[model samples]
Target: MKIAVIDGQGGGLGKTIIEKIRRELGNTVEIFALGTNAYATASMVKAGANDGASGESAICFCCKNVKFHCIIGPIGIICPNSMLGELTPSIAEAVFNADCIKYLIPISKHGLYIPGVQHMQINDFIQEIILELKKKLTH
Candidate 1:
């Protein structure tokens, strides 16, 4: 399976996702790190991404050309001007238009709150993501 983990603003979320995927799934999946900045990409790479790319152009290009089984990241990835405007409209459009399932971690930023998202720690959220991924891959 191929999955892309997109993030920005220090890439802590993406790094954790990549690490969890690597630990739980091992080498069964190819994880791509798509960051809105170089530092974010580097962080994810160090965490265990199979490959990584940075910047809006890189995100657009990869999402457009790669057939990812799923694109996982904060909901900011699809919100234009999110991540302190690091997520441009074009990048958001590209990611939204990609032909893949999107698994977004409902992180409230800029006063944005996802309805029905329970209050939970980051570890709980990551575990939920792992379970979902396992089900998707096995089925």
Candidate 2:
């Protein structure tokens, strides 16, 4: 299955997620790193994404054209002008309007907070996503 792992800024989160997904799932899934900038995309690609793309236009076009099984990223991915303003309104709108399921990592940064998510560790959330994806793939 195709999975889009979107991230912005330094891409630390996407790097971690991509590493875990690689360790857990091996080469079974196709990972596409969608980053807000070239540096972020490069980071994820180094972490083992099968492919990658960057910038607002690339993100919007892919979300609308490609049929990924799911899109995974921070909650800011849907919030316009998020990611410290790296994510543009068009990018956010495209991601939100994409015809695919989205798995959001509850990041309490950028002045955004999600109740019940603040107590969980980042690794825990990544693990949960990997586990759920594994189950779905086996099914």
Candidate 3:
């Protein structure tokens, strides 16, 4: 299956998620890193993503043309006004309106204010999401 890991800012969270998915799913899954910036994409690529792309235009193109089975990321990926930068309203809306499935890690209100650290442990959350996806895929 093809999966896209979308993120912004420093791309730390995206890299961590890509690593976890790679270790757990092995070569059975195709990972695409879609980042708001070059740093974010590079981070995931360094973490072993099969492919990586960045910038608002790249994000928009992926959202429109890529036939990813699932898009995994934090709620910010869906919120254009959030960390997604140039891939704002239009791109976010396209993603939201698309037919592909999305797995969003819920972030609390106060948590959004914190920079650097995520609201919850991304490792645990990503593992859970992966497991759930595995179950669905297997069934």
Question: What is every candidate's alpha-carbon RMSD to the true fold?
Answer: 1.1, 0.8, 3.8
Models sorted by lDDT, best on top: 2, 1, 3
lDDT by residue (1-139, candidate 1, tens digit) is: 9999999989999999999989999998999999999999999999999899999999999999999999999988999999999999999999999999898888878568777776777777878989988998899
Top of the candidates by lDDT: 2
Predictions in order: lDDT: 0.92, 0.94, 0.81
The TM-scores, one per candidate, come to: 0.95, 0.97, 0.85
Ten contiguous residues minimizing lDDT sum, candidate 1: 110-119
Stretches > 4 Å off in candidate 1 = none
Write candidate 3's Cα lDDT for 15-48 as tens digits: 9888988888888889999988899899999998
Q: Model 3, stretches more than 4 Å misplaced?
A: 84-87, 109-120
Please write out the lDDT profile of model 2 over residues 21-108, one tens digit for every residue: 9999999999999999999999999999999999999999999999998999999999999988999999999999999889999998
Q: After superposition, how far is residue 66 of candidate 2 from its true place, in Å?
A: 0.7
State the TM-score for model 1: 0.95
Indicate the worst ten consecutive residues by lDDT in candidate 3.
Answer: 108-117
Clash count, one per candidate: 0, 0, 0
